[model samples]
Target: MRTALTIAGSDSGGGAGIQADLKSFASVGVHGTSAITCVTAQNTRSVDSIFPIPVAEIRKQLRAVLGDFDVRAAKTGMLFSAEIVRTVAKELRGTSFPLVVDPVMVATVGARLEQDDFADALGDHLLGLAALATPNRFEAERLSGIRIDDVESMEAAARAILRLGPKAVLVKGGHTKGVLVDVLYDGRRMRRLRGRRYPKTLHGAGCTLAASTAAYLALGRPLLAAVESARRKVAAGFRQSYRAGHGVEIIDSHAVPD
Candidate 1:
C-alpha cells in the first residue's frame, strides 16, 4: 500500500491534529504514519492545555518514520512552537516527496495554537519546501498582511503567500460570507473552487482537507486534481458530520470511500 506521513500534534479529543490526519489518510486508503510534535488536552469545546515534545524527541520520530516508510507524501498540521516548526522544516528540507503545510494558528474553540514567532519560522523555513500551503481566511490575513474581505483581496493574499515560496497557495474562504470559494494559485494561473455553504464550521475540516490532499498526492495525483479531490472528500465528510460533544460537530472521517 502507498504511505503518507503526518507531522503534527496529537489531539486527545480525536477530532483534530494527528488523530484527524491519520483518520483522513486511512479514509482515502493510504497507510498513515505520523510524528507527533506535541500533545494537547482538548475536546470539542476547547483545548485545555498543550505539552510540547522536546525537539530532539520529535526529530527522532521523524527520522524513524522516514527511515522505515517510503513516505510518498507528507503534511504538517500543528507545530506549536517556532522551535518545532524549524525542526520540522529542517527534517523535511531535501526530501523528494511532496509536503502540504496546514498553517494551523488557532484551535476551533479560539485557543491560540502557535507561539508568537511560529509564523515567521514557518514562512522562512517550511513554506518554501511545501508543495502547497493551506491557510484559512484569518491565517491568510496573518501570513500575507492583507485583509481578505472579498475574492479580490483573497487572490491578493494568495499571491502574497505564494511569494513566501510555496509551489502553490490555497486560500480557503470558509471564514468569509456567502458561497465558499477557495482560491488556488501557482505562479502561473489562479483557479477558484467553489463549495457548498455549510451552516456551521466542522472541527478539523482544515486538517482533513490537507491530509486528504496529501493522500491523493501520495497516490500520484497532480496538485490541482489532488486539491479538488480533497475538497470533495471534505464536503462529503461535512454532509455526514456529527457531534461527539456538546460543542461543535466534526467531519465523519469514518464515513469514507473504500
Candidate 2:
C-alpha cells in the first residue's frame, strides 16, 4: 500500500493537526505516518496551551519514518518555531517526494500558532522546497503582505507567494463574504476551485485538504489532479461535518467519497 506522512502538531481535540491529517489520509485509502512537531491542549473553543517538541526529537521521528517506510508524499502543518521549520526543511531537502506545506499560522479560535521568526524561517527554508503551499486567506495575507478581500487580491497574493519559490500556491478563500473560491497558481497558470459556502463553521478543513492532497500525490496522481481530488474531499467533508463541541463543528475526515 502507498503511504503518506504528516509532519505536524498533535491536536488534543482531534479536530485538526496530525490527528486530522491521518484521518484524511485514511479516508483516501493511503496509509498515514506522522512526525509530530508539537502538542496542544486544545478543544473546539480555543487553544489552551502548546508545547513544541524539541527540534532534535522531531528530526529523529522523521528519520525513523523515512528510513523504515516508503512514504510517497508528505505534508507539513503547525511547525511552531523557526527551529522546527528549519529542521523540517533540512530533512526534506533532497527528497524527490511531493511535499505540501500548510502554513498554519493561526487556529480557528484565533490563537497564534507560530513564533515571530517563523515567517522568515519558513520562507528562507521550507516554502521553496514545497511542491505546493496551502495557506488560508489570513495566512496568505501575512505571507504576501497583500490584503485578500476578493479574487483580485487573492490572485495578487498567490502570485506574490509564488515568487517565494514554491512550485505552486493555493490561497484559500473560505473566509470571503459570499462564494468560496480557492486560487491555485502554479508558476505558469492559475485555476480557481469554486465551492458552495456551507452554513456551519468547521475546523480541520485546511488540514484535511492538505493531507488529502498528499494522499493523492502518494497514489501517483499529478499535481493538479491531486489538488482537485483533495478539494472535492474537503467539500464532502464539509457536507458531512458535525458539531463535536459547543463552539464549532469539525469536518468529518472520513466522509464518504462521492
lDDT of 1: 0.93
Model 2 residue 99 lDDT score: 96
Evaluated at residue 94, the lDDT of candidate 1 is 85
Residues 151-171 of candidate 1: C-alpha lDDT, one tens digit per residue = 999999999999999999999
- Candidate 1 TM-score over all chains jointly: 0.98
Model 1, residue 59: C-alpha shift (Å): 0.2
Candidate 2 lDDT, 1-258, residue by residue in tens? 899999999999999999999999888789999999999999999999999999999999999999999999999999988999999999998998999999999998899999999998898999999999999999999999998889989999999999998999999988887788999999799888898888777889999999999999999999999998998888899988989787889999987467
